[model samples]
Target chain A: MNTTSWLNPLAALVLSPLLPGIINRTKAFFAGRRGQPLLQGYYDIAKLLHKGAVYSRTTSWIFRAGPVVGLAAVLMALVLLPLGGSAAPLNFTGDIILLAYLLGLMRFFTVIAALDTGSAFEGMGASREVQFSVLTEPALLLSLAAMGKAGQIGSGSRIEHLDNFLSLSGIYSNLSASVWMRNGTILLLVAGALLIVLLAESPRIPVDDPNTHLELTMIHEVMVLDHGGPDFAMILYGAALKLWVFSALLAGVLIPVRSAYWWLDAGAVIGGIFLLAVVIGVIESSMARLRLLRVPQLLTGAGVLSILAFALILWR
Target chain B: MTGLTGSDVQGHLAVAVSPLRSVVLISGILLVLIALLAVMRSRLLAGRKVELSGTWDCGYARPTARMQYTASSFAQPLTNMFGVLLQTHRSLERPEGFFPTQAGLHTETGDIFRRNVYRPIFQSVERLLLWLHWLQQGRVQIYILYIAVTMLILLIWNL
Candidate 1:
């Protein structure tokens, strides 16, 4: 647990920015172009932090406080999540619900702050973000529930607790049996749902285009248009941390390797992060962002997939 | 008048003493008392006015209600998009072509919850339960038949 405490924040601080860089590099390499350095994001963040921010004339205190709350909420989620095969720092009976709600709180504030700028472009982006989120959240929760049920902690166990040693071993043991085909099926379905959620949550392709300059279609980027300097850096770091946390969760479910050696789990966790980044990069390179009208359909498809997984679990 | 026998008087009293009759009588009295109170209170307060004549030094001026904004203008854009759902209506008088005169526009939107959502859902439920409507057709003969059937079933089971 003490190791988990030290490693949780350390991993978030050290590896958060690298995930985005890896994704970009993977995409560049796949496209046959020389990629940016792994440390490029770190340097960019440092430069941003050294500069000053310019406030928008139309914004209120919410605009200034938005990034701060966003960063804090993401960090809090990190503390609630287990880095590898270790328990989180703050484990409670129902911590996973709190974890998801904290992220929701961050999203709510971020959207409101965007709207406070009174820019129609930002408002449009905010509206789309909220609509997509409303469809995406159920998938996230249901998928996590399926994964939890497969581990035999189905009744009321928090998702964050699934990272513990006993729970990890239980999940692996159940997967090895033919009688638990339902469990395996649900696990695979959840992985698929989570893959979609990863795209939706991080503003990746097929849901949002982070690299797009067109203000009318941008979701996450348009919301941060008025932010600069340290505030912008905070937003970037917060997004990176969220990506790392989610990827780590996906890794915890997919990777069944258990070891008493902390370094081994840490290595697996890092490898999982790298693998997720590559997967995301491949997806972005392969597909275009969904049309604005069709994005809802994609999100709803994810929700239905998760519900199917849940129904399979219940049937079993 | 002939003196009533003790047995006849007891049978009449038993018929009059019923829980349902008491409940109906009490509720009827309470309803009348509430209506009377409401009428008397309104009459007593109708002519009363609060004097604000010297409270302000501003010159006397009567205030009109036209300064307020109407709900229609506030919800114009929303009403336009969902006019079918809301059952909105509009009436307008426009100026004549080439030579303009007085012009005005009026619009109103109905609540979709009543017209579209609730009424349709309820109608579908009613259709589904159409058979149950025959059970309560407001016919005395049908009600008497139902009661007779119920009592006969009870008697057969007891036997």
Candidate 2:
């Protein structure tokens, strides 16, 4: 509600592209090669925006609508997020559910658009996408629910009057060092679940290989193979923003720096996010992508962790 | 459309409606506007060198719709997951020998409820109804005798 709350979405819009750049640089560092510039993501988007698009004859308006609608959904998710040490610009009880479903909406459009292409490769990608999301979504929601429960415990009687006490802003803002100290195990479990969800949702290593050339092996990237020019730019930027959004959620839990100064809180959260991205980069460098059959098991493991966390909170 | 106007309803209504007002509506408008922006940006910056071509199929000069992913293939993963419940029957004939003659894979998924539940019940109903087939006999005398017997029974009961 405060004027400073605008900083969260603004920061996300401006700096999201950097997270991917940082991750790429980290991977390059591990590979013993000088990486592209940190602003490479921005450059790609700019170049893409400067080019013309080619539409498949098989595609309809849904193909065109995918990137724009997806970007919009991510933007909506970003606005609902509480970052730095403040509430989100738009926060209400049950906004957590909205945040999750907004991502779902984005994915729905992307899948349908891929299907609209009527390409076998894109269809393969879409199948893998929906298949993985079947596991990923439950993990995400359960993890968020766990965090909400932990937040409820932290806020105690204050949120009792509300119909649903699990707003993203409320949960993030309620997270503090003391709460972490008290519920360290639950938070740890939830954080692990969230990290897996982040990697899976963002199409990172282990769950998927973003750089895979074989369409049979790829998931997210293959879905957009037919998109080019400004549409591709939107997709790319939307992806970066999604990674940023998930990173922010994870960082919020990992770094509970709730300070009086908004700048300090924002700085810590953003720093935590960059660190998480570096972690992801290092992970990609060290680990091979999981076998397609194994991805579901990994996602199911995350769900188990979240379920465990929720159980811990419930019984406690 | 009905409106909630009273002050008592305002607080709860506003709280519930804010997400629709702020997130959903804004996102919808933004989707259209940004899509238009993308179109215009591409137009302005592309400098009119746009090209249309077939989707890259690994440079196979000739590609047909038959080779494209079918709806069934698209749903293959999900169907495979629920195969036991769906009862998707599949048959594969792999080509043999140096010069392969024929290869085909056919999959059929039928309605589980109809196959497992409804069909048996309907079959039993048909068999039970078949027992009454002898009543029709294809004869006018049989119908007259049946009517006379019904009339005699009715008179006896009345007496």
Listed per model in order, the count of residue pairs whose N, CA or C atoms clash below 3 Å is 0, 1
Pick the TM-score winner.
2
- Which residue runs does candidate 1 get wrong by more than 4 Å? A153-182, B1-159
State the lDDT of candidate 2 residue by residue for A26-105, as single tens digits: 99999998999999999999998778778877788788788878888888888788885588887877788788888999
Give me the overall lDDT of model 2.
0.85
Error of 1 at A247 (Å): 1.0
TM-score of 1: 0.65
Candidate 2 wrongly placed segments (more than 4 Å):
B1-47, B97-101, B111-159
Residue B44 shift from truth in candidate 2, angstroms: 3.7
Candidate 1 clashes between residue pairs 3 or more apart in a chain or in different chains: none
- Per-prediction interface RMSD in Å: 24.2, 2.4
- Candidate 1 per-residue lDDT, tens place, A20-48, comes to 89889988988999989988789888887
